[model samples]
Target: MQVKRFFAADMRQAMKLVRDELGADAAIIGNRRVAGGIELTAALDYPLQPAEPVKPNAALEAELRKTQAIIATAQARLSLPEGLTAKKDCQLFGERLDDFKNDFTGADHVANRVAEPAPEVVGPAPVAPHAYESASQDARGLDIVRSELHGLRELLETQLGSMAWSNMQQRQPNQAFLWRRLQRMGLPATVAHDLLAKVAGIAESQQAWRMLLAHFAQAVDVVRDDPMDEGGVIALVGPAGVGKTTTLSKLAARHVLQHGSQSIAIVSMDSFRIGAQEQLKTLGRILNVPIIPVGADQSLTQALAPLAQKKVVLIDTAGLPAADPAFRLQLEALASRGLRSKNYLALAATSQAQVLKAAWHSYKQCRLAGCVITKADEASTLGEVLGLAIGQRLPIAYFTDGPRIPDDLHRLRAHQLVSRAVSLQLAEEPSEDTMAAMFASFYNDLSRKVG
Candidate 1:
């Protein structure tokens, strides 16, 4: 069997690449999302009919010889002085364990054993110290087991998530096609399936897509009431370099535009980076609002005491990884200090699904009320961001597609998001030939239906 891997920005394109190189008979083994796009692995069995096995080519023979030589050299190095090696030790131990198991429960022993129950005997009372020690050990063991189970559960969930798309493709091609349409835009398979399932039995492609988008729009939750309208403390939290400060500045500027700069106050908790405060301060200077810098030792409440009377207070947090120990500490400090703020995770549209998921999971500790998608102009696909929001049910607060201060920040509308996602998906299509092939197949089906 010969195997090849193809990578594309989406699944349909990946499948096209696979079909072009491996032919229609190629069996797809696996597929997954990589750094830039999706990867598909397809395999083909060389011998299609009964025949003599093909012999290896000269190049293959040479490669096999080289591989054998490398293996021999590694084996020689791993050999011990007495002929026993690490591999052999493991093999021997496994064999002994198997033998022990067989010996302990042999057929003869089962036949010779009595079936009658034995009389109960009184047992000694457990020692207090031993009982306490046993309890401690059991508690520790239970913790370890729970941790392992949790890891296993996450692994299983990821695997199951991957299978959802493929299973839908196999079971219901038409519904799966609609599902992939949403998936191509970067939505999770499970989310796409759930949406598609709602509009079942729709045969026409255009009608299906229309229904899908309409349903998608209903499912999407946008910021109905902007935090700035009736805002207290609104913090922008996300991973590093996701344009958190810029987003905060945009929101602050937007607030200033509507309700004068006097009613708004900008506070910076992003003391980790050298110029984070300066950027917000620069925006503060531009908007004519005070940018209060809160130090590590300073209390957030104390820092914002003067701004208590302000209509809106936008807090800019340090863009740190969710897994960082410091992130939890920051959350703890915010909670302990009674920094009641409506947190909004600043996610970039250019981020992959996993990266967005990580950001969502991490900043969720802040009790994020919603998300604000930034860098929309820079992002080639909005599907990943949209999918993250829909899957997590995170309402989108605002969208900043460009760098324009208050101008670029627009309210999140469901129709606009769906349109952008579809446009991006269509824009990423492969070359003319691939598109022609797809259209030709569609034409043939239409012609047959007419006849």
Candidate 2:
């Protein structure tokens, strides 16, 4: 047998070197971690007749078979109990087997050629097929065990959560009822838990319920006066389809109705969307307000400079995505110290909690003066928007229930908003299992906070 030692930064590179120099029939006799990486000792039967097929020497064949058997045993041992450590071991074993292959056979033959240096040898030995089959069986078994353990873990968590919920109902029935009520109202777990924690000592159910609503209403911040009446230069900012244009029209119409149309001017900064400028022009025509169209190349400050005589210059911005370059440009323009613009985020009440939150985070970069809750009449529930308003302390300015210009807009009232939210609560309570899962998560959060 001809023996040669190869060194590389890793097993894969070492195996590649062995294959390239010694051809694919090389067998890895021994391998160990060296100073830089891996050192592999490979051997191949030599002094063969070129006319006939090369046959490995008996001693070397036996050693290769012994090595294959050892590798098979190790792979079998990889079927350890399902856990983080065991999963890591299985992954490491599979990776090592793949590295040994190194484009010799292909990824599918990772389990084949157990002691071979290359993934695919020029000609596999007689023992290779058996080794491949055995290793493949071990890997499949490990996968099956891992899947079963994952299912078992999920089942265990569900059962434990259910048990914990039942125990909590027995110990603190009032608190449990409140949790269910809050969950049914579609309030986020963190917000509901904070309320529950605050009213933990209130044993009486009715009083607890009353206090919860009171606390919820108190959390909703609102502007002291109608924003339309006190506007200098107010810009409506939010994601697309949230009624920024409609809300701006409503505000302008409201101002037109109360004060003369001459004091207000609608500056259309939405040059991107088709007919967006036309829509504002139409509204301006109906309301008899001046429509100043700012083109894409026009500076917003210079545009506003011409309208300095106008009292309430409602900047109707393009409802582009927060990440868009144009959107950031508009935000930076609105936040400029020269304009002194008070930006109000136009959030649709019908949007999901996450969507509303994302909108708030996006527009908040411009230092939001307040939020205008639009599409209230179309929303199934107001809890999500209310939760966002309360959590962010974003003062609610005006809410529009319909598409009507001035009639649909109403000033913010905390108690009325809370009542509207409570009225939209789910008629049926959540399932015991669902409640149990929620409670488990809530308690986990509480524990973490306490710790």
- How do all models score by TM-score? 0.60, 0.66
What TM-score number comes out for model 2? 0.66
Q: What stretches of model 1 exceed 4 Å from their correct place?
A: 1-173, 428-451
Instruction: Write the residue-wise lDDT of candidate 2 on 1-451 in tens digits.
Output: 8899999865545767999989999887766666987788888975444565433334434533443444455345443343323124324434433332232232223333333443555775566568667666656544443333333323333443454566557666897899888877778777886787778789999899999999988888888887677768998999889999988888888788888888999888888886777889898889889898887678998888888887789999888886788888889999988888989988898899889989988888898998989998988778788888878888999889998877998885899888878988888988886786665455444444544
Clashing pairs in 1: 185-383
Candidate 1 residue lDDT tens string, 220-240: 878888778877888888888
lDDT of each: 0.67, 0.73
Model 2: how far is 321 from its true place, Å? 2.5
Q: What is the Cα-based lDDT of residue 328 in candidate 2?
A: 87
Local error of candidate 1 at 179, Å?
Answer: 3.3
